[model samples]
Target chain A: DQQVKQNSPSLSVQEGRISILNCDYTNSMFDYFLWYKKYPAEGPTFLISISSIKDKNEDGRFTVFLNKSAKHLSLHIVPSQPGDSAVYFCAASGTNAGNMLTFGGGTRLMVKP
Target chain B: GAGVSQSPSNKVTEKGKDVELRCDPISGHTALYWYRQSLGQGLEFLIYFQGNSAPDKSGLPSDRFSAERTGGSVSTLTIQRTQQEDSAVYLCASSLDVGTAVYEQYFGPGTRLTVT
Candidate 1:
């Protein structure tokens, strides 16, 4: 069972525009959520994260918004650049879970310059 | 300040053969995890090791799949009698520790295994 799901398999946006990636989870026990960016033939790199208690967290041009009631969270990249094109994965872990993360299928973002 | 590293970046093995993949976690990091990613699929948890505690092999697909962490530093994942379906990229990650605090996991480039 996939606890975390990224419904959109791919997204395309113009450079300098806003890019929004969405993720949903079924398990309410998950307390921490994170986003990772992955390029071809490379490992995923950490992007940003948010706690269950917080609704939003921002880092530089990336922002993550969480809605506990909806079991939904989103990653927003402002002024999206061509370099932002990659697969973004949403992962979650609960307390005492030993940091074992459940990752989503990932959304492929393409920024056209 | 090296990140996680995996050996044999690419492996091509025939069916019924056995393959062992290795992972070297970051120095001083006590948590290690193994995951498999198939084409067009998300990462699948395989196993986890934390300090000297018992390893969590709950996510292992079958008895043919196993992992071992030696000295709490390097880890090895073995897949015996590999099948064509066993083809995938095996990824290794390490984190400082596990607790209430959210620990970011650093991943290696991964070992791409192809079972022919």
Candidate 2:
């Protein structure tokens, strides 16, 4: 079963606009969440993360918001740039999981110039 | 400083043959993990190792799959009796778990294995 799910397979946004990618989880044990950006032939690189203790975390142009009650999270990129275009994966882990991450299918984000 | 490194970026083997993939984690990292991504699928956890502790092999699909981490630095994943269904991009990641509550894992360029 897919504990983590990215319902949208892809997203497109014009440059300088905001891009939002959503993810949902079914496992209550998942307390930590992370987002990774990947390009073709490259490994997924860590972008941002949020803990169940906090509702949000931000890094530069990227912000991750988590809603524990709903078991959902979203990554927001403001003033999106073409360089942001890539596949974004949402992953979750909990103390019970012991450092292993459960990843979503990934959402391809296209930032138009 | 070098990040995680993996060998044989691409490997093609015939069916029924065995293949071994290697991963060299970043220096001083105490946590290592193996994951694979099949076609049109998400990353699937395979195994995990942490500082001389028992390895987590629950994710291994079958007894034909196994991994070993020597000296707590390099890890090798061996797949026996390869099948076309075993084709996927195998990825390795590592993190520093010493005295840290939250660890961020750094990944290596995956090794794409094709079984024909």
Candidate 3:
């Protein structure tokens, strides 16, 4: 069974628009959530993270919103640019689970110029 | 300032042949992890090693897979007998430690292994 899930396989957005990617998790023990961006053939790079204590975290054009009650989270990118095109992965980790992260399948984001 | 590094970016071998993949973590980092990504699938945790503690091998799919970390810096994953189903990209990551508030993991370019 997958503990973390990304329902959307891909998303497309126009430049200067907003792009939203969603993820869901079944494990209630997960307290820390993170998002990573990956380019083709490259390793994933950490983007942003949120603790279960906070409902939202933002950095520049990227924002992550978490709904603990619903076990869902969404990443929002405003003024999306062509450089933002890549695969986005959502990962979660429990405090007691050491440093192991459970990752969602991932959503491919394409920002059209 | 080097991140994690992996060797033999791509490998192809016949079925039943054994293969070894290597990973070198960042200097001074005490935690290392291995994962496998199948086509169109999320990463599957393979193993983890922290300091001098026992390595976690719970995620190994079967007895054919194994890994070892030497001096807590470099790790090698070995497959006793390769199978076509074993074709996938193996990823390595490392963190400073496991007890930190921000358990950020830095990853290395994966090694793509193909068993024919």
Q: Model 2 off-target regions past 4 Å?
A: none
DockQ of 3: 0.71
Span of ten consecutive residues with least summed lDDT in model 1 chain B: B96-105
Model 3 Cα lDDT, one tens digit per residue, B1-116: 99999988999999999999999999998989999999999888999898999998999999999999999899999998899999999999998774656488889999999999
Compute the TM-score of each model's chain A versus the native chain A and list the values.
Answer: 0.97, 0.98, 0.98
- In candidate 2, what are the lDDT values of residues B8-45, reduced to their tens digit? 99999999999999999999999999999998888999
Q: How high is the CA lDDT of each candidate model?
A: 0.95, 0.94, 0.93
Q: What DockQ does each candidate score versus the true complex, computed on alpha carbons?
A: 0.83, 0.75, 0.71
All predictions: root-mean-square deviation over Cα? 0.9, 1.0, 1.0
- Residue B111 lDDT in candidate 2: 99
True contacts kept of each: 0.76, 0.71, 0.58
lDDT of 2 by residue, A1-113 (tens): 79999999999999999999999999998888999999999999999999999999999999999998899999999989999999999999887666799999999999999
Pairs in steric clash, model 2: none
Weakest 10 consecutive residues of candidate 2 chain A by summed lDDT:
A92-101
Candidate 1 lDDT over residue span B61-87, tens digit each: 999999999999999999999999999
Cα lDDT for residue B62, candidate 2? 91
* Candidate 2, position A111, lDDT: 94
